[model samples]
Target: MRKLFRRQGEQRKIRDKSDLIVKSNGQRNSELEKGINFYAEYLKHLDACSSGASQLSPSDEAHTQNSDLYDGKATFATTQSELLQKLEDAYQRESNLEEKLKEKIKSYQELKEENVSLNKQIESFTTGQTKLAEKHSRDKRALVEEIVELQRRLDGLTPSLALKEAQIARLETEKDTANNQVRNVTNQLQCLQMKLDEARRDEAVISKLDLERRDEMDSLRNSLKRFEIEIEDYKEKERTFAEDLSDLKRALREAELLGKKEKAIAEKALEENSGLIKENSELCAKISLLEIEIAQLNKDNEFRKMNDINLAELAEIRESEKRSKLEVSRLQEKLKAEQERLHNTEAQFDEYRKKEEEVGQWHHRTQKELEGLQTLSSSLSNENKLLRQDKLTLSDRCEELQNKLRKKDEEFERMRDEYETVSEHYRKVLEKLELETALQHERAGEYEDLVNRVHQLSASLSRDDSSSKSSRGKRQTASSENSSGKSTGEEKVQFIVLNLADLPVR
Candidate 1:
């Protein structure tokens, strides 16, 4: 029993030390220890006083215990004025606590009003973000429609290009035929040139034959004159030479006939040669015309080749246009993807902002709750302190009353035992109260740690938000630059297309 009492006393002393330390907040441990030691010494003094009083009159203790449970009231009358003064002080402390509570409630109401206004502002921002998102979606839809139309136009243009290619192929075939005709005409001109050379040689031979015929006729005429002279000489011989003269005349006649026949043959040959010359001149003129036609055909072929080059260039231009169109489409797709990512990012940002706002609101609420809980804990601590003081004074009065009963005799012995039992029960209650206060202190520490962690998390999230905003700004600038680049590419494609259009078709 003594050991239990000692343990209880030790526990009470420890509780008092912890309470004093808590009340001091940051005061020195030495002060707390001194306070605890002083309380322990006071408790020991009370115990000594009670022990001395208990031995005074143990015989009348039972009778005193049975007489009146309220008999100690008259004995406590001497301390009435002091008790009234303590009560008045307690009322003042209660009123002060009430005023502080009212002030906290008013501040809580003001915080609630401010939170509502901030929520309204947040709602307006969200609505604006939503509107901008809608506009972006509409723009995306329009771009998609425009792209589809361009694709349709490209599809239409493909068949025209094919038809143009077919026409070019036909033009190439025509050019080949014209080239063959030119080659055939050139071969004919070469053969005609050889024929013209042969004709010139024949004309030279005809002129040489005409000159030999003239010389032979001149020689025959001279021989005839000599025969006539001989005839004349023979006539003088009269009758003897008559037969010879007649023979000579007949020979002269025959020579005359041969000369006439030769003249006719020469005329006929001259006529035939003149006709051949006329025919050759006609062939030369035809050859000249054919040469001119061949030259024209060559010029036409050159033109065709140039047309082919132009067509090839046009086809190349078309290919480049197609490539540009594909690039544009690809860029559009990239833009679409970027827009989608931006949309997703915006959504995530909005969600993060919402979560941050919620966290801020939660932090505020937790702070308020913690403050209220702290105030309640402090009030409870103060009440516990006052209750302990009251209990100490009551215990001192009870010891004095007990001592008086002991002096009254051996009849109060049973009352003393009952009082001890009641005292044991009260000690147990006080120990339980101390344990409860200790649990509250531990809970308060946990709440403080939670608040600190919340603060740290909020700071980290704020940093992340700032970085995201900067990155988003960079992306916007990059997107603008890409748009400018695409516009330039489109301009180049348009210029190429226009140049291709201006090229002449074969």
Candidate 2:
């Protein structure tokens, strides 16, 4: 009994420990689930921010146009610098998140290891319970066998003393019935134990699924992190492109203004060149008239040399030709200057065309870049959509698993209740068996006393016969009375056996 009680106490302690472990595991699981949910939500928020940035990117062009060129450039420079700083900050944040994720992974690994250990402990505890149950069953069987043997001995000893064999047979039948009840109860207990083991196995499977889900979540998070980094890189490129576009637009505008000024300067130079050409033609005609007049005067002089004319007129004509030659020289120099100015204007115009071509090329390149960025943004959005779908599917699976786990828990609780009730019934049966054994011992003791009294009466009757043998009649009378008393004693012994046998087994 003391051993049984001690075993019960140990079993209770083990049960309590198991319960504590289970509760702790449950709390840890809940905490892990909460952490996972938090990370999931955070990832969703990041995706939203990325999508919003993509949506707002086109509007930046309109905003850029509204601002003054120089002011926009300055602001763009500052914003680009700030973006660089923010990118750096983002990198730092990503590193921190990675470190945190690593720590979380480590903690999760530790939890997994702890869960495994706990599962092993649970298994060991279950094995111990099974062993204890087997030992109890063995003890009960041994006790039952001992009771059967004791009853057999009582049956043999009391066979000739009274008509009590039928009562003993009935007691033996009752013992057999109790034994069968114990066997049936034990069978039921075993079945319950099997169910409990299966429940535990299911729990282990659920834990495994949880771990797999966590691993998948980690992978998804890593992928999302990579996508975020790529998105940030793309955003930086877009900002740089936008800045370049703004600068190109500014330069193009300045080039256009310069080209217009040069065109006007070229047109004025062309008009001056036309006027200089007409003046040069008029001066050449005047020079030609002078040459003809000079030829006429020379002919007249030749004729006058034969018949004498004034030298003064010829000298005056020579001075007039010299002045005309000087005027022609001045006009020719002015015309040369105008032509040089026209050539310079043409060169400026050529340079302006080259610059315009360069602006067109830059515009084309920027457009292509914007188109590429748009395509990249579209792809990223598609990926985000896919990721969101995956998350939703994972969540649904998790919910289903949770529901299954809840059902398993409910079943486990029900099994535990059944086990407890069965154990209580078994304990009651054991107690009743013990009481029955105790009663059997008392009855055996009373039977031994009756046997001793019978032996003593036989011894006294033998002495009386020996002492009164000479008075034969009186001896016969005394013997008959002794026989009657012995018969009465036998009847009393039978009555006691019947009464003991008639007692209910329960």
**True-vs-predicted CA distance for residue 100, candidate 2, Å:** 99
Summarize candidate 1's per-residue lDDT along 1-506 as a digit string, tens digits.
35444545555654565465445433433444465565577557555655655665665544444343234344344345544554565556556655655655565556556556656766887898899999987975565455435434444454554554464456446545655755665565565555545545654554555455445545545654554554444444433334444554565456556445654654555565466556546655655665565566457556767776466755665575566556556655655665565566556556655655665565566556556655655665565566556556655655665565454434344435544665565565556556645654564454345344434433433343344344546566654544343344344334434433443232
Tell me the tens digit of each residue's lDDT in model 2 across 1-506.
Answer: 35444545555655565566557555655755565575577557555655655566566744543443455457556756765665576566557655655665666566566656666777898899999999987976565455435334433545455554455456557656766765765676577567656756765775676577667667766766776676677667667766766776686677668667866765676676567667657756765775676677567667776676666765665576567567656656765775676577567667766776776687677668667766766676676677667767766766776677677667767756766776676577668667656766665565456455555544443443344343446457655654455445445555555554454433
Poorest 10 consecutive residues of model 1 by lDDT?
A: 497-506
- The parts of candidate 1 lying over 4 Å away from their true place are 1-309, 410-506
lDDT of 2: 0.61
